[model samples]
Target: MKHKTPLLDQLESGPWPSFVSDIKREAEARAKNEKGVDFQIPVEVCEDILGVMELTYEQKRTHWKHGGIVGVFGYGGGVIGRYCDQPDLFPGVAHFHTMRVNQPGGKYYNTDFLRKLCDLWDKRGSGLTNMHGSTGDIILLGTYTHQLEEVFYELTHDFNQDLGGSGSNLRTPADCLGMSRCEYACFDTMALCYDLTNEYQDFLHRPAFPYKFKFKFDGCPNCCVASIARSDMSFIGTWRDDIKIDQEAVKAYVAGEIPPNAGAFKGRDWGAFDINAEVIDLCPTKCMAWDGKKLSIYTPECVRCMHCINVMPKA
Candidate 1:
């Protein structure tokens, strides 16, 4: 009995046109040689054999990996490429590179910048992008060893502005859509994110921590960015006081004969929490009252939370 040649053995032969076709041919030949031509091997045989062959090929390709940093020029060039040269040691990694591009607040990029980035990726990268890695930098993938520095230089245009990601320093800072778009925004999240990035360029490039750190900002309580779940440091805006009630507004509401639940105080469930009447009853001004038709809140004893205010905004 002779040992069967593996399906991939042919791909290792001089330059093969298509590994898949080569495997198919090998499979046919194996069937013929085994006197099992009439017997149908499971379709899964092809899949399993091809998978194993591809894995083997990939293992050979990754035997030596090459890696280095490349940066896009201006506005802080992004970090690109982590390729390895030694196949015996690092292999298939040469086929893939990782590049980081800085994303502005709200992940907005000007048309010129976007075009330049796309052109660069098409010319040199794997033509794939992660569009914001874990650190919030746009991640470009795939490149070769020889193309690393050239791609880096081309992307950075000679290190003019600054790059956004890499090393031990702080990654890109992400911010929510601030005052420009959100009505509840109280601060300029965009300006703050940019300021932090510019002020800490050194920190962004140098690895100087036991672990990586991330900073994120939310314009309001809605927290659209999921900052609280992932960021080490996060800032979210929230109102500290309760809703304000105007007595005149309440009178107008009453005169208008609007439902007690109408207006800014509508659809509120004040009873969601157990109210302590002992605390309300001890009110220095007997301001808390439930009159079946409406709750009365003496402005003097009203500490906010809009409990009574929601029940009777005209209070």
Candidate 2:
């Protein structure tokens, strides 16, 4: 028996606000004057309704089921279990997405690996994704009734990458590009960040913690990543000792070869204005001395403030 399209039937059935009304109209028009309707009849429906129905049915079908598994990947990797909802679907299988570990500083996968992941995503589950979720993990949406382990095996076929960050765990850390390029850097922040990530991978993936943790590093005092503001753990490099002062360099600065205020030394109001008398007197090392005609640095007492160099630039 042929069934008239449900579209128009549904629309004319009620004035209730819905997309079902529109589709019912279309379906009725398409299957005009049809007799009996089969349960298999494919009536057009909105994507949202279809998705909702699919999810609802899936949940119902799998409810009370146990042992389903899911995985998340990004800054770190790990599997999660949903032992509570529909234990039937995951019988002996854990529920929840596994996390994929990430290299420190947000490294991207190589072309081949990326291609493989895309292919796997297309075949195994819902195409929906969270590129970098709050925990900094790549989130894959919707896994099947089974096949979690297979998916895990396929994804980790290459060298075992880490699944680093997740719930209650230390989050993926970030840092500035350190001594490699910047002149201001006192340490290799990038390397340090990576090392820390490796050293603390367990702390990253586990859910055992009093509170979520975050870490960040800066090569210098600039604090490029705002480590102090956002991170539970933060590091910034600075010299415990005074800045280095070259007496000859200071003289050269005095002779105009170097600008007195070109770098950090260029700031004003050093508590002294006169190069020979006031500024020199303030030097902790008594580095700066005046002969009433020419200016000289004791060299041994030079505290590296570059104050005398700034004032007596012509000495």
Candidate 3:
């Protein structure tokens, strides 16, 4: 049966990308497949998912009913229990649960690995996934209670992977792609992340802590991973010594020969670069000064905030 979702359909008309559109597309595909071809999830499940969501929109409240503590055997965390309140109307989504699969270090994966993972989820899950959730895990969106163990086994045995932490356990540790791509990296963020995850597998796989914990690693002060703001334990790399200055590059920036902020603002017409206003003035510690041609930095007062180095990479 075609599910009428007028309220949810309104979300598809705007300029922004809508998840409603994606779900509708999946629902349509599943509906057309008469022979139940492929490992695609049932069309009723997709339709019921839309039905439940539309009900919530119409009622201005959630229709999800939290189930009791539930997870796969031998693992206390990773699986989250969710049940729809209107089970009779949406039985296909009645036991909808979520599984958090631990992503590879730095999220590196080959095509074979990804295809196998998708195939596994398609066979056992609702076929919805978050590429990488906030905690840096692959979120497998909807499955039944009975299929949890089989899904976990296939993940571990077939895919050679495990689940990420949830509940009171240590959440998945995430790190920026450090030495692999970033030149500013002072340490091996991915290596450290891998090592720590293995060292604390017990804590990561079970609810051993009173409160939820997290670890995030950033190779340099740039903190592309937002380690400082989000993680309970943050590892931010920084150089303790003085920053080496390149006089020729500094002159190049001053002469408008080089773009500021490593050419990040190249598209915008920000006019000429100003050393005193852009670099020195923006320095949090106020330890830098530019004397016409030369840039001076007091070593002791420097907090190594990286603003100067980021602005003048050559210097």
Winning model by TM-score: 3
Stretches off by above 4 angstroms in model 1 are 1-81, 84-95, 158-161, 243-315
The lDDT-based order of candidates, best leading, equals 3, 1, 2
lDDT of 1: 0.55
* TM-score preference between candidates 1 and 2, better one: 1
Worst 10 residues of 1 by lDDT: 35-44
Candidate with maximal lDDT: 3
> What's the best-to-worst order under TM-score?
3, 1, 2
- Give me the runs in candidate 3 sitting further than 4 Å from their true place: 33-41
- Model 2 TM-score is 0.45
Candidate 1 vs candidate 2: the lDDT winner is 1
Candidate 2 per-residue lDDT over residues 1-315, each given as its tens digit: 122334433445665765445433433543452533321112221222223333445455543233343444332225543332533322221233333445436344587866666456444533334565444456654444354555666656753554545456787787777776666677788888888987887787665587778888877666777677868888887656654445665456444565544445556554423344446667767755555455555554554444543444333
Per-residue lDDT of model 1, residues 230-258, tens digit only: 67788776555543445555554445454
| Per-residue lDDT of candidate 3, residues 225-264 (tens digit) | 8899889999999886777788999999999888888899
What TM-score does candidate 3 get on C-alpha atoms? 0.93
